[model samples]
Target: MNLSLFILLSLFGTILSALIAFISAKGQGHRAVMILLALSTGVGALSSALFLLSGQTQLIVLQSAWLFGTPFVFTTLSALFFFLLNTVACLASVYAIKYVEQYAEIYNVRILDALMAIFVFGMQGVLLSGTPFGFLFFWEVMSLSSFFLVMADKEAASVRSALFYLIMTHLGAGAILAGFMILSGESNFESFTRLAVLAQNLPPATLFGVFLLFLFGFGSKAGLVPFHVWLPEAHPQAPSHISALMSGVMLKMALYGFLVMVFGVLPAAGTTASLIVIALGLLSALYGVIYAVLERDVKRVLAFSSIENMGIIFTMVGVAMFTQAQGLSDFSHVAIGAALLFAVAHAFFKSGLFLGAGVMVHAAHSRSLEVMGGIAKRMPAFSGAMLVLALSAAALPPFSAFMAEWVFIQNIVSNLATMQPLVQGVLVLVLAMMALVGGLALFAMVKFFGIGFLAEPRSEHVAHAHAPELTISLPIYLLAACSVAIGLCAPWILKTMHFAELTNTVQWHTDFALTNTTLNPFALFALLLVVFGLVFIARRASSNIQNERSYHTWDCGQPITSGMEYTATAFSAPIRFFSHMITRTKKQVIATPVLATNKWIASRTFSLGLRQIWYDGLYVPIQNTCLWISTQVRKIQNGVIQFYIALIFIALVVTLTIAL
Candidate 1:
């Protein structure tokens, strides 16, 4: 079968399954449709992978010219994204067997089934779109589907979060449309391919304007800092499986868009533009980690961490572009390769981590980390996965994240050493700050996995950890395994990555000596096992296990209580204290003091709340202005047919005046 047709048919299959699911609303029928949904996604994913590997896939016209000869093209880039989307969507479907069924009682099974299929279909369309007009159209469709998915819960917070996500994304869509129109104006032709050829005629200033517009539009969707207000709310609002897809795969689609539009089409790398992107990236990385560190909600912490990782990738891309423009293509290759690797690694580990978080939330029935502690004993499999994911997120040695971060930093350091004095200094500072961000990320992850799962259970429910079904656990296990494999075999993976080919440039290989600086996961895991074996042998030889006495946590010679343990809030206290001046933390407390003694135990209670810098700084002001304008407009629409007639007459007069 033709690859494009097969892919489209796969999507059609999803729609078919959805329709079937809707028709079969009860018992045996619903079961059959659910099976069909999984089968469709599986076949679709397989087809996408096949197309990605095949060289025959090209721009195949499924219909006539779309918006002026802009027909769909099956490029390697678009195919790669489809490969990712379908693969994850397939896995999520397998997972949904158990995950979605749990909520079947509360939600209409038909609605979940159809929306799930439509959501996958929409994402595929977004990735496969061949023209700017088509892409934007599919982008909105994808957002609309996801918005409905988010709103599926229909709880108060879910509704609010869904609305916030919908509004923010729509605003981003407007910017994106404007940018595409600007790009279209520069082109006599309208197709993506034609636009690329026509882009050469565009003035540099106009190109830069379009670039900035895209940066805001795509960056907002990718949850870059200063534009990441909706992510925390939206992720928590969705089902765990959907959260996995969103955090794992959906955001990458936005990144793919930015790369295809800006770097892929523009074909020029300018210094000022690179610096702006780099500066924005650095700020985002810093801001994201700071907020993640202070977050007590487990899912929100992971969500903010996604922003941080995206920031890191963006910074690497910026550095690469700067170097490439400066004629240091070797350094540029390394930088860009590292950024892509990071994205791939992040997709695996972050999704695994999110799934682990979902399992914890499901078992504990809460999002607060303070209420969840020491599930390691009860939920070993879930905790084990969480630990590995946490280690990867922290960029520890032998994880894929470590390899990516190392390469990224090396590229940054190499570029800084070779660049002009001012650029070098600024880049050096950015790299230093990035290193700090990595450290803070480690701190945050430790708090998330350790304080949340390592210590004694803080709440009664958490004390008895429940394991989710194998369907949910299997995907997490598979991704976790991939994370380890990719880290260990990064050199081999790099060869297959075809990094230089993406830019249509000469391939630059990494030096084996440099690659040797990082230890592979196989070696790290082996070393750990050996160390653990030696400890076990030593303890066995000493026969000291029987003599060991169980004791409460040492609390300065006093009895240890749950409150005395390091709560999530207390664990993040240092970051909150340091970042308060910038990120701005809010605390609410009520205290009653009988006397002014410093040692006195006063009756007191406290709570913590956080707000994003962008919310207070940008979005609110714009929202207020929009509200004011709407209010003024609302005054014009009084409940009167005569008033409407008068308005129509005024409009006719205005039209006549303009025509005259």
Candidate 2:
């Protein structure tokens, strides 16, 4: 089949699905619409995979012009991202079938289904867009659709979260616009191909300025540290399926923008830019994981974990940028490949984790880990799937995340010998930071899984928790399976990605043993399977010889209560104490009198609070300054026409003088 024809059909399918969903919103056909949306997404994914496998590297320009008379370009890179976007969309849609049923009465189910379809469409448009104008148009569509999705609950908090997200998104978009306008300049070339040539002739200072603009622009959307305040607030407010998409693929769209700007447009951006990227990525990774470990809210923990994973991805991207600047194409290939691999792995596992969180939240009637416990016995399937996802997020062996990180570490260490002493020292620090981030990630996941699912129920809600329906559980299971499959098939997946062509490196080894890498997940997985089999056989044999007995544990002559169980807050207490400076943790204790005549304490109340250093120290000051300036400007608005005219005349005169 023709590549363009396949893309066109997929696009039509998505649009048709959205239309049908809108039409069916007020009726009993919501489920059917959702199923159709999933089917459409699956078709898109298949088309994208076929395009990539066909080795269609040449850009296919859409004959029909989009907004601003700009065409869309479908290249191998775009096809790869399209595959990822559609694959996740398909899973989210499937999960939403049962998940949204709970909200069917409270919210507009039709709007939710329609927005999901449109969101996927907008993402596809962004990837395929050939010009800045077209990309920005679709970018706004994607952002707005998600904003409404975040505000779907219509609670005061969700509304506030949506507004926060809206502001940050536009700020990022404005930066991108400014950078693109600067690139276009007098010629005003709309096509990226033309802009690439124009960008090469720009002065060093001008190029660096453009790079900074794109960094802040794309970085904000990517949830890089100072600009990341909106993420934790916004993600948890959205419906769980939407949250999965936002964390899984929406952030990756920002990453797609970054890659295009840095590699495609400003290939000449040198070591200084690369160093800055590396530094920011390192800081975000460390900061994110530390907060994840300290967080008590279930969705908030997952939100922060997304930030940490983004940091790891950006760190690998920085390594690729550095290698490319130094003309080390081989190392650059491996670094960028690792980033893409991690991205795909993260999409699968993180989406699964968020879906599982939704089920837990529904079962426990809350999003707090403090309220949840001992759900594994009731929700065995969910517990097992969530465990797989948590381990993957923790970057343990026999998972795709571990393989990607392993590849990243290998490249960083291998390239150190060829660098200057100062560069080598920086690389060593980066390596150490990566190790620390991985350890903290494991700690956070353990807190997430162990607190939310393992022990006795901490509240009445959790005590009677039930498993989610098959419709919801199916998607989680599929995603978990993908995470494992990707790891075991790492070598073939790497080869098929065509990193060799992109970085001018040799074809990767095609052995199931992963012969050229430090560790082989396939071999490790087989070994683990054999070990489990042996242990199971031994246990069975022992059981046959002697009858098994079950007994309740003695509580040391005292009755135990759920209150004695370790809460999520208590689990993370030590980490919070050590990182108090960064976390800005505060505690309060209040004592109440038992009687008016006596000073005897009746009860004590304790509470803990965590603060964002960036929000308080950086953004708050900027916000206050803006408010102060606005207040001063308001003083001039005295409802006088003469005063407004005089101000306008003075502004025109100043503009004329500057123009002359």
RMSD of each: 4.6, 3.1
Summarize candidate 1's per-residue lDDT along 1-660 as a digit string, tens digits.
676677767777878977877677453355566567667777767876676555443556365654455465666566666666776677777777777777776556677677777777777777766677778777887888888888777889989999999987998888888877776685443566566666677889988888888888988899887778899889878887788788888898888888877666675768888888888888888888888888888899999899899999898888877877778777777887787778888888888888778788877779999888878888788678778888989998778898888777765654465578766786777779888999999998989888888777788888776777898888888778777877888776665433324444444454522364564556777898899999999989988778889877667877665676798888888877777787677679988776777637677889778967688879889989999999999998889999999999999999999999
Q: Candidate 2: what lDDT?
A: 0.85
Weakest 10 consecutive residues, lDDT, candidate 1? 497-506
Number of clashing pairs per prediction, in order: 0, 0
Predicted structure with the largest lDDT when compared to the true one: 2
TM-score of each predicted structure versus truth: 0.89, 0.94
The residue pairs in collision within model 2 are none
Query: Please, what are the lDDT tens digits per residue for candidate 2 over residues 532-595?
Result: 9999999887785556577655678887777888888899988988888789976798888788
Clashes of 2: 0
- Clash pairs, candidate 1, are none
The most accurate candidate by TM-score is 2
Quote the positional error of residue 553 for candidate 2 in Å.
3.5
